[model samples]
Target: MISRRLGSIAIGLALLGGTGANALLAPSAEADATTSRTYESLKNGSFEADAGWSSFAQGAGTEAAVSDLRASHGQRSLRIVDSSSSSAVGWASNAIRVDPGKQYTATALSYVASGHAPLLYLKFYDSAGRELDSTATSASTQRGEWRAFPAVSAWAPDGATHAQVVIYSLSNRTGTFFVDAVDLAPGANASLTANQYFHVQNDGSATPWGWYELDDARQAGSVVPDPTDAANGVLAIRPHVSTGDEWSGAVGTRFSASEAARYSLSMKALRQRGTPVMHAALRYYDRHGEVIGTDRSGIDVVPGRWQESSLTSLAPSGTVEAELIIGCTGTVRCDTLVDDVTVTPHWDTTFYAAPSALGSADGSTPESAADYRDDAFWQEVDAALETGTARVVLTDGQYDVATDDDALHLRGIGSDDHRLLVSGESRFGVVLTQRADLTTYVVQVRDVVNLTVENIHLTADGTYVTPSAFLITEDPTAGERTEGIIVRGISLTDMPGVKYSGVGVAGTVPSGPGVVDVVVDDGLFARGGSGAGYHHVYATRGATTVRVSESVLQDSAGTYVKLRDNVGDWVIEDNIFVSSGTWINNVQFIQWALYNTTEPGNEFFSPGPYRIAGNVFEAQEGWCAPQCRVMTLTARGYNPVDHDGVEWDHLLDPVKREILMDESEGNIETRRAVVRQNFNLALDDAHGISVTDNEYRNIDTLMTLWNTSDYGAPSQGGNGVYDLSNLFATYRDGL
Candidate 1:
């Protein structure tokens, strides 16, 4: 007798003769037309029967058999016990026929009771039964816990028609392991999403359902009944630690995860005893089982109280597996209880905005585009940014942005794991313009990360001199600093005037942290108010890893780039810094006043290893009348004479000057920098700069240090500029 099954329906064939001869059978036309064909290539994959598998033991004291002792799934598993220290032992599945040039993935669940981990492999064979190639996962070493083999995928080699699923113990191990629920299917496996939320049952068993000791060899613990609910249970862990390592006592569950996808984890934790802190966290691993990133929940678990902790994270690049870990830190003796763990993925959404669209106002599509003037539309955007991902798409039109506060207040939004993007239909078509004269910035972003603003034009009323076109600041309640900000393909301009034009794009170190990882690329920052306070790109203090490249910084009332105090690891390259008639003073293109401040808590200043290369500095003829310098580097008291004859309202008086010059240095020394491979066109001499490998056109005396008699030189080892070899690569490496 023979049997054939196609998708849940089976057909049986029986011979009418008594001789037991072979016979040909065909399906009826009606049956063939209505049914589809499928194949279960790997027979008895669940290890319910031992018929489709072959086992072997090549060394002394090795054993392999189908056992009902323990299993990851179903009621039975293939058990392999190895006491042999020099030979391999395990089971191999019957050959599963495969097509050449097609990819396949083999997945299985394994539980190691005591010993080294077993390795899973997919071995391919050619048409002649010769072995071709194989792919294997590293030994998964989370002992006494059930773990999925890191998925192994391979393409069938040329002339190959079959493959085998192999589970074997390494040559030098002495332990017992079980393999169950093995599968071999075409294509790679999908990320697991079904068993995200787990609840303990009445019998004190969880998913993959087993009660065992904690993974750490020294830790002694188990699954116990929940104190609050007698019907349910919780994972109870007690750390056995000789050191106070954060991961000293941890239990983890691994799942398949996609790279760059966002996930959130939440669980209820209770600290019962000891002085250690209890935490719920996640660790991401790559294909080779190396940990790539770890994110810990910020909520603290207090003793005797069940507190829920939540965390959101983005899987790093190249991540293949993610582990949810509950652990105790800071002490050797601690008891922690965890229950009701949930993991969720945050999906992405796209929003549309236009001038006249009004269908439902959901921002889901062009027909349902959000009205730009609707406060509810912006509110919805802000809400999406907090929890998940959002992309704002704007149509080509003028947007009237007139408000007393910032027009767009991106406050307490986004995170390092998820980013927000605002983009226009075209680079120069969408305009964000101020309708009324306001003193604040057009767009103010406070304590946001991974935000990108691009492909728009930002401007103010011709009469209103706003403080800044775009500003970045910190809100301590949200984060420590604003980071991962990008301003690309934008045109930002301040009100035009010599006396009081504001900055184009500015970052201020208010009372908290400053900005970092800021990139201004392929943009225009121009038309600023004159004086020492206004600039195209300005940072008062604490601007770390700020880069300005492939942009135009032109027609500034003050210097183009001004960085003061505690700035380092900066790059200014591939830019055009041109001074027009609006630039009246003899201001330089770049200014670095590396000064220290006594702002109570923030004091230290770092002498940066800086890089200024591959830029062009040009000035219009007869412009910058008094003098023109390419760049300036100085400390606070070094240029006191520049303020010697200042009038009232100069922001600095003689008494304040004396106090500033008399302040303590705090014993911080400045590090010199390199300015290389630049082009200076018709500009006056430079001060305190080491110009190297630069080209000059109609400019005399390009390399000039500050004179002590004429301009008050910087103190030795203080904000002095010089050239060094291979500085760009060095500074980039440090960043």
Candidate 2:
């Protein structure tokens, strides 16, 4: 007998007349169209028989079927197939119409009654009997247990356009089985929105739903919001401080905002005190949740009263959304109250440029404005110096000069804001030359003292080599002391071609002992010619009490900072030393030779003691030759060397040394030097130095007395040497 079925509508044909039948044709056009067409369940139900398993059943306004197929719980039902098979041979199957060359997801929910096979197979075939794609599942089934088996497959029927699923049962056959509740759906997957917030419920006794308290600068209240409700609920949030300690609101969503527009956000805040200033910051974020813009405002918070504050700023380029933060670091009394938060676009209207002055070089002076190389400016400056009231101001533009004489000889007159740029590229020689010939310049006290030079940037190209850059040589025949010269915020670079010092200042040769007090601050000294024997920045003889601070010196072969003989009372602080080389060396801080020989007293030495503080020393190995001595301090005098005169203090003591390194040891070699308190001396890479009051930890060699002027090894007196108190001899192999 031959049988055919179209879903739940089946047709059976029994070959009752002949044994040799060529073909049994049931020419029913309705059957052909119905069997070829696919059926999708619009409702949900169970299957009572094998034939019924292939039919679509509807229940409770939902489509369902029975073939051991099910959908994810709480999800909309689509299509399903169920199988009822207790043994391997008695497995049931189902057929469904599907589009050719399309993909579909089929799921099966089932459980074994009594047996456990290693695996189960699911096969697919076309209406003409060609195989498509096959899948399998592990075969450990329990009776009446339901499980969902999902398989995603693509159908490529050669010519036929429909496909069906076949279930292969295990070998053992036993109890009866039933299939129910299957589904199949279209489309890929779904995603959540940007502003969506999720919360998990914890069963409790208080309110049936989870709730917390809110305590901020502006207000104190309890939070009670339903987790199931997506809107109108308060969320617990924490704040972060980027610059100062203050609390502010955080952004809840990431929304794209245009860059060509401006955004302003307003919020209300309150404080506990009468009135206090609170910092409110609006931060912009991009699509990936990165901060891009920050707008800040100071809000006044009144006690128990809410005040509104608005912050405005241009929208950042490519900014989508941003968070707003409010905080206060002054006191806890300052609290931020936020309500009715609003964001909007900015609208404004006006623009203009300032008017230019007549006969003034408004940054439009040509490169050939003034002949810097000529002796004209300096000649006028020198003549004005005789009357003692000379001041030169060169505004914004470049100045060219070609002079064989002193560029600007300011005897007692001061020069400021004048970028005395010497640019002839070919006429390379000394830039500025100062002398102490008169008592004033421009009728304003020139040579007697008190001269100031500020806001000057000097540059020289290394294209040519000459005598020097700038020389401040005084005449000893004047029989007067030249003092008080403040040079602030000046930059000198690329003039390796000149000889002498890049910027030199020296006093009278032997004119009753000359004294020059100078201050050089915030300058950049770099790169000159090699073998020219040129130091980047130098101080010549008879210059005392010079302070050089907040400057950068780098990229030269010669010494970066140098002090000649008779120079004293120096403060070198807050400077960065880069490009490996000797930083400062040679010449004593306090030399007795210049005390009685040149001047009446030791005004030639640094005025009293000097200090070198807060400077960073960085060296690149093998590029520039490293200095053997990082810093050298000496007191070459016949007087008794005490803590009051020419004394060096090492700031790193035992505790400090231990904090800086795992271990250290050494005694610094300096005259009247005091090692600061709390430093560990007996650590690796801290040996062979001299410092006062250093702690030694498991150090094998306590002290090495070599070439000591006082005494030999075991009896060197007044030497700051402290041995390890708790000795561990077993680990003393390498010390």
Candidate 3:
């Protein structure tokens, strides 16, 4: 026998979207396609309960029990109080069952007694009787009123065909539990939308998104959301500029689109004050986050209004996934509001041509495109050269030249994209030389003044005995000054056993300060014979103000870059010199001298100012050779003895012999040289030279003054002695 007590009650109802109070019914098994239902219930007193279920009060004995309610007219009254007892306890014999592989929502009409709270506990079990998940509802009201208690739970079934749903009381206090109009059913379809809700702030304090912003703008915002709703939200951004700041921002949209699909994006922007520059960019990234496709366009925005900008281009090859970024960068103070973002995919119909090949200029020659003498293509270039407006493009391939005086020349024309491949073993490679003194090769332009020379290979089979593989000469008699000459992105190699210099650029006297602003970037100069004795690449007289940066000069017998007396204001930066036989013993790697100036009177006179910074001079581990000197200033030709009766001002201070040893101050001596911050020298062998402020790191001996000539003893004023700051030594070691 069991008895139940009366508990507390609370009631409230929320109308969903002004719908009627039509209760939802349990969905039928055949209604599995759509999990939604509606129903209505009538009030009745014919409550019903199955046999073997019992209820009782906690203080009452088992004999005193409550009776089960019976159903009448399809309705029943779930009595809260069968007896006026302190606490109610109830139990059912059989477990409630549910179907597997389905989700159900259960609700009950329940109320509790006054001063007694009632909580609903729901326990779910698998078909194998294992508990999956359990939850409890909040305490109901203690008022004496009937209320609808809607409790819903979702369950996923395993392999079992049946599951149990147990509903029980969680509190041990005295209360009445009334339940009626119970219903269980499945849930509806689940779908999600894509929206850009996240913000990316560009504060200009770090790299990445922040770095993309203008220096003046404090920050920018971006958002990323689910892909489904990606087409819904507007990517709105504001580009603001202060008095001393720049405005910039980049917004990137990531997606996986078809490789062959042509996509375009259009943006509408509103500007506030100054002229605004906005750019729309499309970029594709692979799984490794490498850029595979990129298209960009920009528009200027007028003050006080809105403007529209659009960019369209063919997606890069093999781009399966890509990111579309809109960037705003400029000094104008303006706000750009973007909207109406859309992506339309189309089929591509454009044809792609493979890169052109490199060959010789002789017609009717039976040779491969890579061969130096493929006359068909060379004739095309020669014809274009005659017009002075043809572009000769050489793709990355090997070309062999098999003639003595068969030179490759582009004279008095606007030719571009000339590439000479000079790497790897070959039966014979091309030798590109200037046949006429007035000829010049025009490479691609970079950074407004620099030019690009694609790979140039100068290889020769073991038979031909040539003096030089490639040469550029300017005759003073002709009075020609080749201005804006740049040789970048070319690999030049001299074949083994070549006696002459591999490449030479020589200028004759007085074409008015001759070749100016010559640059060589990203090139490899390797393998020349010792008999050349000058340079793998030599810049002779009148080649002024040259820069050799970002190149590797290795495995050469002579100097890498040699500039004579006429070359001034030269810069050799960020270059790697490895396995070179020996530099010019007479002149330093960088030299300055006043030609024909007498010593004593011309001691302070320097031929030119050359800055040799950020270069690495390394010796191969077991190679025994003298370490390279930074610079050698020669006063040999212009000494006081050679001049007439005029005494040269001693630039070398007799009082500061240690500082005057290398005369490094002369390089920066006049304060005209900008040697503020740089790494200049490093050598394995320690010669007795005082390397002043150029910091040396991890060196065993910081500064050694070798006693070649007994200028003094090992003391402060002694010439052979060395005084070094530990700070200078530690700094050099780190480098």
- The model with the greatest lDDT is 1
| Candidate 2 ranges with C-alpha deviation above 4 Å | 1-391, 412-448, 479-481, 529-533, 580-607, 624-628, 634-735
Question: Could you give candidate 2's per-residue lDDT for residues 1-735 as a string of tens digits?
Answer: 111122331111110011111111112221001122123321121221112122222222222233324322211122321222322232223334343323444444545444442232333454544445455554335545555454434332322233444333333323333333333322221001111121212233222111222123323222222343323222323223323444433332233343324556665555544227766565677534776777777776676765777766665544546554445543243334343344544333111101112233222233223333233444554444443333334434333223333244444322221111112221111122222121211011124344445444445422444444544445566545555555544445555454545556666544546556666664545554354245555666666766666555554435456665556556566554444233222211111222122111232222334444444333333332222222332222222212234322222334433332222323331210222221111221212121222111111222221111121113112223232311212123222
lDDT of 3 by residue, 35-84 (tens): 11111111011122111122323244212222244311112334443233
Error of 1 at 402 (Å): 3.2
Residue lDDT tens for model 1, 1-735: 111111221111110001111000211221001111111245445554323455544467888877789865434688888988877786666566665445678888888888888878787765455567677775467788778888788866545557777777767777888887676876632213222222332233332222224454522244444455433245566656635455544444466554555777777778887654666667799746898998776456689777887777887755658876666656457677766566665557678888656688788887789876566776777677666666788887777676754266666666555567778865445677776766666667777777777777676666465676677767655545677777776666554532322223334555556677677776656566656666778765656667777666666767678766556556676565655444455547777653322212132233344556545455544555544555554433332211133111112334433332331333111112111101111111132222332212112122222212113332333232222211222222222
Stretches of candidate 3 exceeding 4 Å from the true structure: 1-211, 215-237, 241-390, 395-398, 415-451, 463-468, 477-479, 494-500, 580-610, 621-626, 639-735
- How does model 3 score by TM-score? 0.42
lDDT of candidate 2? 0.36
The candidate with the higher lDDT, 1 or 3, is 1
TM-score of 2: 0.32
